[model samples]
Target: MTSVHDGEATALGMAMEQSAGTVMIRAYVAPEQMGDWTIRVTAIEAQVEHATPGLQSYQLATDVYAEQQQARTWTVTLAIPRVLVAGKAVQLFNVVVGELPRLGFLTRFRLDALALPEDFGPGPGFGAAGIRQRLHRPHGPLLCRAMRPAVGVGTDTMVRLNRDVLNAGYHLVKDDEVQVFADNRAFRQHVEAMVAARDEAQAHSGERKGYLANLICEADELAERWDIVKTLGVDGVPMSPVLQGFSTLSMWRASGKCRSLPTTPSATC
Candidate 1:
């Protein structure tokens, strides 16, 4: 018999067993297809065992249904037995949305939400507290500066802008997500110049500041850029995990090179 975790948060708490795996995903469905959706969603997610013995499989355990748009729209919240995905967020997404297209029961559907177990990855290496400490701004709103016209802006221009911002009392400055490994603006030179500007500004402003350099590059080149940032002693770096892949960010955090400096995840422009 399949274990059904019903109710709301209370049942979710009760379903948390060491051996029991579970995850919650919300999908929209047509009002008429709720019955078939309940049956197929559960079986496809959890019932089909993985070909590999140790690999985890999900079963649709329970669902919460709701009506919206004057009963014109229907949404279902599916409680699935948790399946662990170690390295690849892409694989995790595959598990969530891969089977839906094969089953043509729902009219229009979207994977809207995901709830993972508490014991996930290393979490954030430097969280808000750490970022505050690094920037030397313990309280009040944090000020941020961004490098505009990211493309074709050479290292000299970037360093000059950072210098102005640092002197103008901006606590944190970041490279635009569009700024990747470019010929005109190389990663190493940009970081080196930013570091130089930061030191020069600190001497005058007497306030500590940080730089979140952009590391949006090819998947294979992520590690190389991360190393450049660390080696050049850049204060921090901004990573576009959606574009560069979340696994890259995970590797950077686990690399232990960014332990002292903070790493921020940015969305692709």
Candidate 2:
């Protein structure tokens, strides 16, 4: 939890020490294009400079080629001004590897590492401890389930599934990422039905159970969907941040609506 002042001081100190903010990027240059890698690096530097204002300096590390290895790779490390990315997740990502893939010089580009001065992103609304507290499970595994048959099912079928799994001791259940509001049954009706089923199961079992509605919709509908979940007292939500964009998750976390409702990010890859 680095404070803003501390981050600022650290950034200033790094600049004075000629290091700046530490952000490392790694990419594999095509073997045939190795000779022109410097030009690519120059292009990258120019792009980074344009993208990151107030960036103090950057350096490209020595190229590494293993003996008898065909693949050649370069590591680029730089220190950016902390203010540029402080508390900004999307900006941080953009500054690091936004358009680097579009450079068309590297065979493969990867973000190897990142060092943030402060708690840069909208962190988890309810971390592990909070989740445990909410679920009333102080120890042991908190079992979770994803509703199957993501599509082609009515709200009644989904509700029955929720009730059955929750009654059988599952701590949490969520909608699959493929389940969208529009393609499936009415979003509000489906969510409300599932929530009701969850409540009934919890009351019968005398244990806390959670329901996470899939809230992956268009950008304009995100807030509205979130509001529906919150208002209906759905325990949490499952979202595909990569598909929806990381900023969507950041916005949700920052909106103050996620204080009690937990979010699970569905895997994209």
Candidate 3:
């Protein structure tokens, strides 16, 4: 998939200099608006007879930009997995701006592999046993949450629910994906109330809890709401995988705008 890296932690480009395999695809996203850039890459000429998760027809593209004080053009080419066929020896590819990431976006016909930036983080330090050993809570069922849409429940109700949920011993409560509109009491309002409840509950029970409000707004409004949530000092917020899109999440994780982990929730594509 060809995606734009708005200088975030997850936007990476790798270009091999005669097998360079590594030079990040540089983007020039304005700090104020880390916009999504549709990339143009390779695609399939025919459907494969047999394919798995990674072996499928695709058209990828990414826009490359000149870096600061640099004078070279950057590009990337991906080696097609030995599964799908393009009906020809080679194909042309380039970026095609569309309403969404699309199959027809590959028009430049260039080789694969762009020097995209890589995101880094601490790897899993402890397996299940290790985590259990560290926490010393190995004798109970693993905790999980049931996610529900955050719509219909106005801000006041959500605030009350957040409080009640924490008081009832649930460790995590988040706004569902369907809760991003500002007309029915904005997300900021709920976040403020939720934070207060979390603080109160933690003080009373000496147990830490969180309210992950969903950040499912349009890309234009994403960072703004994110800033509001972060400024309020809330512990967490949720993001819809479909609304803002993964490129946005990648950029979010790439930059620390949403903390170490602004939770990513995906609507199945």
**Model 1 regions more than 4 Å off:** 1-73, 84-88, 183-185, 257-269
Write candidate 2's Cα lDDT for 1-269 as tens digits. 11112223322332333322233234643444433211111111112111222222122232531222222333444556556455676766766665444432233345667666545565555577888898999999999888898899888898899899999989998888788666323788888898999999999999999988887777778767777888898877766666788666666566675553224455211
Is 1 or 2 the stronger prediction by TM-score? 2
Q: Write the per-residue lDDT of candidate 1 for residues 1-269, one digit (tens) a residue.
A: 12222223212232232112233334644445443222122212222321222212242233432221111122344454334344345656654555443331222334557776765554566677887887788899888888887778677787888899889988878888777665423667777888888888888899887777776677667667767777777777666666767555556557765443224456311
TM-score of each: 0.65, 0.67, 0.47
Task: Judging by TM-score against the true structure, name the best candidate.
Answer: 2
How many pairs of residues collide in each model? Answer: 7, 1, 41
Q: Rank candidates, lDDT, best first.
A: 2, 1, 3
lDDT of each: 0.57, 0.62, 0.44
Local lDDT at 148 for model 1: 80
List where candidate 2 sits over 4 angstroms from the true fold.
1-72, 104-108, 183-185, 259-269
Q: Which ten residues in a row have the lowest lDDT in candidate 2?
A: 37-46
Off by over 4 Å in 3: 1-149, 183-185, 258-269
Candidate 1 vs candidate 2: which has greater lDDT?
2
